[model samples]
Target: MVKKCFFFFSFLFSLTFGQRVIFGDDMSNLPGSWTLGGTPGNYWTQKSNRWFSHSHSVKCTPYDNYNNSVDVWMMRSVNISGYNLGVLTFWVWQKTEGNDFCQCQYSTDGGTNWVTLWQRAGDYSSWQAITLTNLPNNANRIRFRFYSDGSGNDEGVYIDDVILYGVNRTTTRIFLENGNYFPEGWTLGGNYNWTKVTYRYKSSPNSVKCSPINGYGYYNNQDNWIDRYFSLTNYDYGLLQFWIYYDTQNPQDSLLIQYRSGGNWFTFATFSGYANWTNYSYNIPNTADGLRFRFISDGTTTYDGVYLDDITFDGVSTPWIDLTTLSIDSPPGLVEFNDTVSVSATVANFSPYVIGTPVYYRIGNFYNALRIVDPVQPYTTVSVNFPDWIVTQPPGTYLKRCSTAYYRDSIPNNNSLTGTVTVVGNFDVGTIQIISPTGTIDSGQTVNPSAKVKNFGEGTVDFNVKLTIGSYSNTQPVSQLAPNEERVINFDPWTAQSRGNITVKCSTQLTNDINPGNDKMEGSVFVRVLDVGTIAIISPTGTIDSGIIIPKAKVKNFGNTNVDFNAKFTIGSYSDVQPVTQLAPNEERIVNFSPWVGSRGNYTAQCSTELSGDMNSGNDKASGGFSVRVRDCGIVSFVIPYDNMPVGEYNPRVRFTNFGTEIANFTARIRIGDYVGNATINNL
Candidate 1:
């Protein structure tokens, strides 16, 4: 995981112990010990396209889409037998389907059974740090597994910079005594010709020689090397000192000193030509775990090779001092613009070294530097004060940062801290919102209008809020509203006189308000009076029979007040009036007119309301047309032979009449018991 920011403290503290990296990998090269399995085709592989720390990282389903129903994993097992507690940290970039998951698991009983540590499913655009803490004492193995369902596939997950830290560990040094034999942990490689020689010695007894024998030229095409490995964990600085004497062919046959870090070796220094036995010291990286001395000879020429002795490697714990910003002590909370106030920060030293450094503080574009004249002792805290600062920027919030300048600081992550400060005007007030009389209102009724006012300044304020709607206006006073406080002000009651949509405004009136942009607010209200109108003609519509037809109309009260009105209905030259009694607000009623003798023709019908104070006249009247057709026909009388005659086929006399003014042709059938007769008549 990557470090983000520093944390500061104002109390004395000591550095007791530090975390040591027990096992880690930068993923530069694939490790031989780590194994990858599950999901035959799609597996986790090492790629160099995206990484967190080094040049490479392990990615699941690299270069192509992952196969469905895959459970691929990359795992490594570590032997944490002696360590009590450990913390595992790593970074990952994942983009998968909603149901697909990326899981981190650990195992204690080898690679047999696993316990889940963390799992997540969804999209993460950037790399995110993940830390697993409180691992069991017997935990040893860790693995990353990606499971995909049989659905949406996307760019898979990438992992990098995996590290495991062990607590309560101490640092150790590596050294070799002057003797006639090689050390226990040391090994010889290549030609294996390196041995201890008595004649050429850097110390008292003897020194290891890379040549065949004394006073003899080395063999041609010779390559011999010796190396030793050490556990250089928990250390931040290291120095390697050794005595060397080289007498090889200049630039052709030489000895190379190299160190190994992260399983890769690099040359630190190269020596050639005749040189006396001299003490040499070189800085070694804290991450280095092994050192080597290799001697190479060309096929042409070679000399008395190289000799080394009295080799020593020591891990040094240097003086480290950390400065932390605790707090900004002056002008707390909020401040007014253009006002001067002293700025200071409480700082602490968390190491065992005396610190004499400068503290720098900044607020937006304004910054200043102050020095800590007296040396801060080990594990002590002090306050550093800068010059007074005047707030000149606009009314808003700014970030305030305080940092310490210490060149010899070991841990630089805790050097600075940041906070926020808000600036406001000295006297400012504004109207927040209108509280009452907003949506709809009734005319000739007294309404109480109210609004919410706020004090947006640094001090208490006294102001007046005024509410206006057309010609009617009222004002209310608010006294001593504290900073960042709000109050709802209600003005005197006003009677509404007009109709339709009217704009209502509320504003704050102060003597010297710094900000007036939010001082006023406007809203709308729909005003309505007593109104009753005909909505529709419910009866005598479409087609009807020609006779005494009755007309009906639907009327509604579209106002705030109730009233009694008369509705008039008319069809051709015939008209009638119906009285509606006590109609409630927003209510509807149906009015029926007297019967009218309508003839056989197409006629237009009209209905209207007669309310004296109808505010909206647009919906007072409604008209419609209907067509009446005369198609009446009936039989006046019928004669049958012998009312109770016997069951036999017989003819009967019948009479028919067409009440309509058109010709009629039809057929008639008569049946009595089992006897039946039929007749067809035309043009009566």
Candidate 2:
């Protein structure tokens, strides 16, 4: 067995003070050095004393004062940051019959000046740390002032330990938001190159003094400035604000920020006066590469140097950016007529910004794409709708475009993404229409002319039914009609600007111009002298049923000259129509019979006029019921499985559903034209 005996002894001794350090349980003379101020003993009071302590604290004693009175402190120097130094925050323990008060003050220029960074005077039942966290970057001396206002029974206060923080700058540190920033006073503006720099500050009292680098020193010197630099590749905005320490010694100091470009510096702001640190704002479009800032002493003589710290830079936002407004970036791809073209685009969200938010994407014109900016988070891209006539595109290059997006605003500032962009393109010539004239018609009359518009020399025009004039019952204003649809355009000579040829231009947006089909309805109408029957709307204007041919006539004679009426009128949408030129004297002819191409509603027929020998002559004679509306070609709607079946002759496996109330005729040709789908002719 190993002889293991631990030797341990507990000693207890109580003795007097003199050559032997006391060690007693009564804790009277067994003292090591627990100082309240410069004495190691049980001594506490509220007064003005102490400079620095070995415990290295900044706390001092508290004194009594009236409610309106403040404790006056006298200290040494201070410096403006490069970093926060140290402070021995003072504290007081009061028996508060009411609220107690404590204040921390620093006098950088001796007892002559003092600046209060923090103060507290609420309930003081316990001890509190009246902090001096705002120590200048070069604060050399400091002090603490305490007050009671003598409200309650003057129960007084008790103070003890006075600790001095920041005795070592190597290991001292202040806590900050991990990812978040200090918002202001952190980021610099212009170029902070020793000469001119902008440093942000926390806050300050009105009057202060310092040597150089301390917060108090910076506040007092106030000669230099801070700045930053950034490139403006396109168009962007920069907004700024700052906190400044205003003092009486610096009666007239101004704060300034400038933009430097083209060898000239433009000052963006100028803040002046005598007050504590506060905030001010400014905005500018940074279209250049260089920007500078300054915080100078603009007083008559050498005004106290303006202590300038903390300058911030941010961008502005344009919230109205819609994806539809976005254009292709860079030398935009061009196109001509009858060619293939392909181009890409950037779609903007026009919404607020989130930290790591995702962007959405869209392809064709599908409505579903709008829900998300992009299918993939990283790439948000869309394509342009290619028009028919496209031409040649240069090799190995993208088109110039502009982005329409609003920048998400944040704490500092918001911005708009108004940037220049480049996109890949297959450029070609765009299709165009001939902008001349289409047809001719007498004044006060209506005419339907065929404006020739074509993309591929042979492609037929395709238009939706809802886009036609008939669908709106012609109540709509003068506008362009879809392909194959009849347009009843009245020539209002009363409103004509010229006399010769009154050209009623088709809507410029029509697809065809020269051909009068789309995008460009172009043709000239020969403005002729007015006619009596010219005002008469064509009755049964289209092909009439060979079985029901009963025609009515209208007679309006205006001319004093005499003439014979003999002309045949026919009826049909595009079926031939004739005019009856010969007729009896003052007698109105009533037509009662359908034309060979008759249907239901109304149509125009060739009125073969056989004038009687007894007929009177005049420029205006019996004219007619040319206005016609064909009723129903068995208005049929054939529903194929898919609403968008391709064009072909293979029957489409369809069902015939009639919207009209009448039997259709299979003998009647199954017309496959325009946008109407191929229909199965029904046997009546």
What is the clash count of model 2? 166
True-vs-predicted CA distance for residue 557, candidate 2, Å: 21
Number of the predicted model whose lDDT against the real structure is largest: 1
Over 252-365, each residue of candidate 1 has an lDDT whose tens digit, in order, gives: 988999999999999978889998876565658788988998888888977787888877675644444566766777655587767897888888878765545555677765
The TM-score of candidate 1 is: 0.33
RMSD of each: 22.4, 36.0
- TM-score: model 2 vs. ground truth: 0.22
Candidate 1 has an lDDT of 0.74
